[model samples]
Target: MTRPIAKPANVKARTRRRQVSPSLLRAALVLALAASCAFAVPVVLGALRPAQSADGAGLPPVQVALSGLAAGACMSLSPSGSNAGKTVFIDPGHGGMDPGVVGTVGGRQVLEKEVTLGVGTRLAELLRADGYRVVLSRMADSSVTKLSATDSVAGAMTASAVHRDLVTRTLCANSVDASVLVSLHFDAFDDPAVGGTETFYDAARKFAAENKRLAVDLQ
Candidate 1:
C-alpha cells in the first residue's frame, strides 16, 4: 500500500492565501455586465434619434428620459474610480476605400462607415467613462491597417486587402486582451422598407454559447 505524503505547514499556508480579492472580483463582474448593456445603447440611439441631429428636440419625453437613464447607467461602477483591469474593443465596420451601405438621408448621403464610427466613438467614450480601457480599431475614417500597393484596385479594396483589414481588427482586440468586443454596423437592403436591428456571434468559437447569450442580450 502506498502512503500519501503530507504537505509542509508553510506550503499549506501559502495554498490557503487568496490570490484574488473579493472586491476586485465584484468589480470585474459589474464591469462585465455593464459592457453587455453598452451594446444596446447605440442601437436604441440610432433608432430613436435622427442622424446628424444632436439635440433632444423632436424626441418624445419618454425617449429623452430613457436616454438620460442610459447615460447614467454607463457611468463608472468601480469604487476606486477605475476599472480593476478590464478592456473593451470597439470595431467600427467599413471605412476608407469601402464605404459600406451608402444611402441618402435628408437629401444628403449617409454612409454606414460614418454611422458606425460615430456610434463606436460614443460607445468608447461611455466605456472609458465607466472606467474601462477602450481600444478602437480605427479612430478616423480610415482602414485599420495600412493599404499596400495591390490593396486597392481601381479605388476598391481587393479580397486580400479586405482579409488583412479584418484580421488587423481581430489582432487589435487580442493585443489588448479585451474582455469584450463590440463591432458596430448598420443593416442595409436594396428595398427601402426593410428596417430592424440584429446581433450576431460566431458559432465556431470556443465561447459560442456565451457569444450567443451576448448577441441575444444585445438584440
Candidate 2:
C-alpha cells in the first residue's frame, strides 16, 4: 500500500486509438449527403414548375375506363316505361380478402359481406320491378377494385387498396350516370348488446341536401 502502482506503458496509446474507422466515417457522411439531396430535390423542382397546365389549353380530366365483368358478376335491370332512364347504383361493402365484420348467430358464422350482398341484390331486384334502371356494384362476393382491370396499377399498400376500391365503385356509378348511389354496410361495435341501422352523408358534398333527404327517408 505504501508504494503506488505503476500505469501500463501502452495505456496512453490504447486510449488514443479511434473507435470509428476511416471507411465507416466516409460512409456515414455519404449517407447524410444522399438524404439531404433526396429531400432538397423535390422542393427545388416544385419551385421551378410553371403556374399553368402543360398543355396550351387545359386538357379534360382523364376518366377511368370501365372493365368487363365476369359471367353474372353484376346485375343491371332496365325499367319498362314509367321510371325508364333513371339509374340507381347499389354498392355492397367489403369482399374478397376483406371479409368485413364477423359474428355468430345460432351456432352459425355470419359475415357482413355476405349479408350486404344478399340484401343489396334483393333490393336491386325490387327496384327493377318498380321500374328503375338498377346497377349492382358487385353481384358476386368480390371487391369492385378486383373486378376492374386497372386495379393492377394500385399499389400493394393497404391505404392504396382501400382508395382504389372506393374509386372503382364511384367510377361505376359515374359510368351509369346514376341518379342515386345506395351503399350498404353493416356496422360493428365492441359492445355485443348494441345494434342499429344508420345512414350517413358527406355534408361538404354538393348534394348534401339531397343526401340528407335520402338518409332521412331511409331512417
Candidate 3:
C-alpha cells in the first residue's frame, strides 16, 4: 500500500512542456530521469518514449531533496591501499526479491539489482586488490527478506543483515576492524522522471562525514 507522493514544484521544470508532441515530450522527460539516480526515490529514464513501467508496479515518488543521509544508504570507499585486513562491508543495495529501480538506459530497460551487482563486483575486486576484507550482503542475487510491514530502513537492514551475517560467520568472523558498510542501490521516483547518484548513512552516526567523504571521492 506504499506509494510516492508528488512534489508539484517538480512539474515546474517544464515551462513550454505543452509545446512538444506527446511522444517527443516523453522522450525528453525520460532523458532527464536517466541522468540522475539518488534521492529519497528516483525515477530514471533514457532516450526513449514514456519510461515503461515494469510489471505494472513502479518506483517511489520524488520529494524535495533531503540534504540528509537515507537509511539503507549504499556507501563506497576507494581502497586506501592501506587498511589491509580491515573488514569493510560492501553492501550491494538491492537484491533478488527486490529489483530496486526499473529504468531504461539507451532505450533498453535495466534493472537496479543487476546494476548494483555489477558495480558491487568491481568494488569488491578493488577492495580485494587493496587487501581489505570485503563482505558482501549477498554474493548472488536474492530477494530482500522483509521483517514487517513497517517498511522502514530496518526492513532493508534486516534483509541485508540476513545476508551479511551469514558471510560474517562463514568468512570474516563477525567483526569489522575499521569496518565500513557500503550499500548500493539505484534510484526510483514516482513520476518516472527523476534520477541521480547519491550516497547516504545514518545522519545520527557520529562518522557520517567519513561516509560522505568516501561517496564524494567516488564522484
For all candidates, the clash counts are: 0, 0, 19
lDDT of 1 by residue, 1-219 (tens): 111111232111111112342222221010011112122222222233222122212222121112112111111111122443565667788788878656566556677688888888777667655666555777777777677677899999998888877776665555445567777765444333323444545556556666667765764
lDDT comparison, 2 vs 3, better candidate: 2
lDDT of each: 0.51, 0.50, 0.41
TM-score of each: 0.62, 0.61, 0.47
Candidate 1 residue spans exceeding 4 A from truth: 1-81
Candidate 2 has its poorest 10 consecutive residues by lDDT at 29-38
lDDT for predicted candidate 2 compared with the true structure:
0.50
Which pairs clash in model 1?
none
Task: Give me the overall lDDT of model 1.
Answer: 0.51
Better of 1 and 3 by lDDT: 1
- Candidate 1 — worst ten consecutive residues by lDDT sum? 26-35
- Model 3 lDDT tens row, 1-219: 111222334432331212332222222122111111112112121121112222111222221111221322222222434545454555555565455555565777676678777877777767756756454545556532323344336345454554543343223212222256565655544444543333333444455555455555543
TM-score of 1: 0.62
What are the runs in model 3 whose C-alpha is more than 4 Å off?
A: 1-83, 144-178, 189-195
Model 1 clash count equals 0
